[model samples]
Target: MASTTDVIAAPAPAPAKPPKRPPARKMVAWLDPLTLVKTGIRSAISATIGKQADRRLLDALAAPDVKPCDVSVDAAGRPRQELWLDYVSDLGDGWNSTYAVAETVARPSLTLRDETGATHETRGGAVLVFGGDEVYPDASLLAYEERTLHPWTCALRGQRPPPHLFAVPGNHDWYDGLVSFMRLFCQGRTLSGFETCQRRSYFAAKLPHGWWLIGTDMQLESDVDQPQVSYFQELAKQMGEEDRIILCLAEPAWLVSQVRPKEGRSYLENNLDFLEEQVFGKKVSVFLAGDLHHYRRHANPEGRQKIIAGGGGAFLHPTHLPRKEAELADGFTPRKIFPSPQESQRLCWRNLGLVVSNPRFGVLTGLLYMLLAWALSVNLGGANVPQALGLVVRTALSNPGIVLISTLVILGLMGFADRRFGRWRWLVGLLHGLLHLTAAFLIAWGVSHLMGSLVDLPFRSLGRDMLSAALIFVGGFLAGPTIMGLYLLLSLNVFGAHPNEAFSSLAIPDWKNFIRLHIDKEGHLRIFPIGLRRVPRAWKRGETAREPEWVADPRDKRATPPALIEPPIVL
Candidate 1:
């Protein structure tokens, strides 16, 4: 105060910088070596140890005894009268697909028309159900937080009267024995602007107008547990004969049972059949599920609907794969299939570019070729190409390590071969391995000849050896995946085998979809299957605080929005 001479006020502190937003997440590269190994190990553990531990200890400890929740009214205690719901599954894979679906889901309202050209407008669902596999490449706290929660949070942020959330655990969700899933979804926490209401992995909700939705937990395709049965049985006692039920499963066991009769029998008999005959009886009007990553619907003459709408951000599964039966054993045929069989078959052709689609897969194959080449130790300096290849074959057969690797490779391929192929799978897998060996041999020969002609350095010199190794690696990288792609193409198109492998390699970020349902005051349900053909790659921050923090950039060339996959279904 004494320094009155032009006392300059302290310079205003620089305006606090807005918190920098994190970089967007990319889609999972299913063919990445790390992803493959991690998922494979988790699948193995979940199938054996995790399943046992969960059944023996975890379920008993985590099972909730809370009564079924009734959502017949809003939080303000007004009668729902009518309700809307959004169902999405196999989500949490890529940022683009996840955000696209989330954006469509978060919209305040959507208007569309059915095949009859009757226009319909709907608000966002008051309740949102995650059908299954909430996170991809296995579920964990980090995976769920980053891949699932963040995208949804950014999409739904600032919304008023958030939708209630419920989920039934899928195989991936069960990988950690449902610990993270329990903490995130079963604790009644508000997640990403959604109010989670379930106190267990599976839930039952009583909607208005004598309708109920039941979600079941099928751990590793095992039978439904006793406590879950008791829970549902008790809930059923409250239902009247006029009431209709909607059954939600982690898988479509009806289709599974037809496609894979032997293994599918266990799923069908132990889960769907038991529940339908013993507990719910003939009251189930709709059966809904995910896990296949596509949309197909089968409706019986009596108007019962069986639908699989799994196109939720994961790579699309082909719908054209030949099944043992075109219709369910009970004579229910597909009324609608998205990406129709013709379109799905066309998409399968993309697998022919496997190396381009999955570069890391090519790198893994390249390293394997280099290892096999090193084991052979072929010297083609002045030798005939045929002789060099012969040497490779002999050395590969003679080396114990090489032999073991070859055997494992063949057996692994056989394991992946669809059981539909039966005994032919063994031969197919053997041929697949032999073809890879042939590719390595050819690559080795080509590299040796090329290096011999181009460089004058001694064969074993570091410079010459490094150059040769590099050439071998490059050749293997290109040829190995190309051969694999061609094999997959032929296998899927011609022999109808390796359907899962064929499409999974594509890692397609397009053809994402989800379902929206509205139960009208008249007790009629309308099903809307929404499809997004291409996800926007470029995104920009919201211009206003009321908007999501990130949104599809309108300037992006691929900014196509969601549309009806097929005409709406009213039942």
Candidate 2:
């Protein structure tokens, strides 16, 4: 070897650096703005003509009432007084979630055979009640065929006499004016062990013990059409004063109290008020709804229960962080008996990444600003276009402000969105604006330093001039993602995370969930929420149907033995 100092000259050639690859494609392709455009178009159409058009024709359509005897009994000795009803809501997404639902469908009798030895031993043929949203992402015939009908049909596996199918139109189903949903579910075609018996989207199923399962059509954000209201009004008149009814609505209106404290009562609340005061004019047993994509059972002191069971093959919604009773303002007592494994931190962190990185709108926003930074560096050098672009990227990175502002804005919007937590929202806004201002200054400073390293363009305080251009570009390109992220942040925080994840580009593998309502021989309704750990891809996974394992909290007062709330106990 040469002298020690000279040995540096013989340093081995550096290991060949690996070539950088373009960023990997997003996990979910449709989670982009293009899909949003398609859905937005459908939503706009529904808002305009679809809702109005359907209103005029409600009465013209038919709603058939199926009797108790029409459905088979739950077990051997069980009388017709007992009924088994399988309820699924916000269904029509994810293979595993639907697979879980299918397993229960394949073995409908298992629900009737409760562990408590609740003696209803007859062969119970359940009526499948879809709490709307049969198919999703526009609800086209293809969606229904692929996501809804085929999946359920495959699950049935030629089992004789499949459950009778009944559904109300959810917001997603209205995307195509319910045309595809009508054809697949409303039309009388009985393929795949399922039958569509109701010509209209809304119906009232006559249950045992003077009970009625009344479902109404809530078209988009509009009111329940006059026809639906009139139909229910008439039905209410015919029923006796003692008859208790289970009201089935597509949206959870009363849950608004969980989010917005000072907001006025929702349309459904007013409708319920009218129904109790004017229509049925008696004690409404339960108010059941799905749409929030989770399970919640709330009871008022007067015994009225508002149960939300939207966990049917959809990403589960995260429950709101528990706050003070005065802060919640919602009158119902939350039954903590069914505590989901979902945590707020995990939900928010995952959703924030998904919302920002996955959406095409968000990606484009990031890239546009990045490109602008490159462009700002472009005119300064005599270097070729490719070389200039690289320099621009380097300069943008040097500034650090671009990334800083983007992150601050996202965090600020998310942090301040909780209305229940008092007036911290203003602090978020103030800090966000200050950070943005700082970013603008840093952009100019970064330009100056970058130019110093390269050939300077013909301009005085060139970096200062660059600030104006940077601001202009940021104002335009950055505005979209900034605002979009803000909107998503507010919605995710306010809506409590589940709706964001359920409807977003990211797919979270949540536990499979549904509910079984069993009317015992005593005419009491017992609701069991079933949750499965995972989907069994093959039939050999288990011999029997899968059911939920209850996760009881010791702190839950309602966790007394048997867990049955005793029906006619009011919903």
Best by lDDT: 1
TM-score of each: 0.93, 0.67
Number of backbone collisions per candidate, in order? 0, 14
Cα shift from native, residue 228, model 1 (Å): 0.7
What root-mean-square deviation over C-alphas does model 2 reach?
15.2
Candidate topping TM-score: 1
lDDT of 1 by residue, 1-571 (tens): 5665767678888998654543567677777889989998988887887545655234545665636778988778888889998999899888888888887898888886555667778789988999999998888999999888988888886544578899988888988777788889988888767788788788899888888889998888556887887888888898999998888899888776544345535754567888998999988998899988888888888888999989878888888865444556455677887777788888888877888988998998888888777777767766687778677678777788888877787787767666767788778878888888888778878877887787664566787777777878888788888888888888878877777788888887788889999999998988898888888888877767677778787789866767787777888
Task: For each candidate in the order shown, give its overall lDDT on alpha carbons.
Answer: 0.81, 0.57
Off by over 4 Å in 1: 1-22, 55-66, 113-118, 260-265, 323-326, 393-408, 455-460
Q: How many angstroms is residue 276 displaced in model 1 relative to the true structure, after the best TM-score fit?
A: 1.4
